[model samples]
Target: MKATQKGRSPRGILAFVVAMLLLSGSLRLGSIGIAVASSTTDVDPKLGNVEAVSECVTDAETHELMELLKARSEQISALEAEQEKRQIELANAEATILENLSRVEEAETRLSQTIQRVDGASSKDVNKLTSVYESMKPKDAALLFEQMSPDFAAGFLAQMSPSAAAGILSGLTSEKAYTVSVVLAGRNANAPKQ
Candidate 1:
């Protein structure tokens, strides 16, 4: 009996836990009484007829609920992290698309400017060449024409004034003149039929 008195029993520990729970406002005196009455007859004086069964049930349920909440929290955090990663990737993809669009727009602008410059230069060169051919002596122009392919000669002659073209053609060999005339006539052969 002396040894039992010296050591703390399960009942004493249970009474202390109940007291703490009561102070913490987790367990009511009425609930404690119900728990103590069902579990043991020899209730501790300090515990005042409290039951351990209800308190144990409440504690077990609270612990299990906390574990479930922790698991759900972890899952929510993982989902949020995945969502954030995808958002970042989407942003990067959008940025890349915008950059490519900008480059394409720049390429188109440059191409248009280049085309305009080439067209302007070609027109200037054709005008200068036509003037040079028109000012040249007919015999000299015909000599140049003879060296050129019949199609090439016809292209220059077609651009000249009719009288100037006739003068140059009169100096050409009859075969060459006929060939040039044929080429000039067929030049518009592909015109759309009415």
Candidate 2:
């Protein structure tokens, strides 16, 4: 009976220790599961923070693009304004040039009219002088012509009647008459026959 009691006591103690070890292992597994669930929930919030950062970066880029567009628009407007001002200046210069041309044309017309009037008055005076010389006596006319240039004496003789011109030539010195005759003959040398 003592030997059997000792054997039963050893077996009972071993069984009790195994049961305790199993309970401790189950508690550890439950704690590990709870920690895994809490970590998964925490990871979702971190992912949301990353998404928010991405959106902020996108907004910053959009703002920068809008500012660049605004600057470009302002530059275009300034260029258009400068072009308009240049066009206006060119139009004014054209108007001024046209006005100056009109004034120059008017001055030229007045100058042409003055020249025609002077030419008519000079022609009338020359005719009157020729008639006066022709009415003089042949001796007096020849004396006057002797002192004049050959060309000037020939001009008066051409305007007189043939008889008066012959009388004046007869009274002149032979040298003066010959010189006057030469000038009158050569006057039409350059004229076209046709």
Candidate 3:
């Protein structure tokens, strides 16, 4: 009878169940033996809280991630600074362009005024010289014209009456007359069209 009782002992059954509960971690053993048990088929809300054990990140890996984040942040800062510098340079260039344009306009105005004054003085001098030549005898005027350079003589002839200019040219040497004639003809060749 003792041998048969040992085979069916409640203590032995409790010990076996306790060992399974500890290994599986889905059950608990109480003083009464197998107080709570969970099977694969059963749905328990507490099962969602269970977590599998996993290895934590090493110190080296943590340090590498921190360095990568720092590098990225520094790169972003540098890009922002470069962008700001470019914007300032562009603004300065625009200001300089505007200033140069204003200066060019002022220079153009001054040049135009100076040209007008020179033209007025030149016209007055030509009129005075023409009057003086007209008052002199044709022979005397011809003598003076022959001594002038061909280009200079051509300028005076162009301002005179056709009859007066012809008298003066007739007095000159044939070669001098032809040279003066050519200069007068080609004088306005480079004049711009309106």
Better of 2 and 3 by lDDT: 2
The digit string of per-residue lDDT tens for model 1 on 1-194 reads 56368897778888999999878775577688878576654556896874444333457788999899999999999999999999999999999999999999999999999999999998788878977998999999999998899988888888899988998999999999999999999999999879
Clashes of each: 5, 0, 0
Q: Estimate candidate 2's RMSD in Å.
A: 17.5
Name the lDDT value of residue 148 in candidate 2.
91
In candidate 1, what residue range of length 10 has the lowest lDDT sum? 49-58
lDDT of each: 0.87, 0.83, 0.82
TM-score of 2: 0.52
TM-score-better candidate, 1 vs 2: 1
Worst 10 residues of 3 by lDDT: 32-41
What does candidate 3's lDDT look like per residue over 76-111, in tens digits?
999999999999999999999999999999999999
Candidate 1 ranges beyond 4 A from true positions: 1-84
Model 2 lDDT-worst window of ten:
49-58
TM-score of each: 0.56, 0.52, 0.59
lDDT of 2 at 81: 97
Best by TM-score: 3
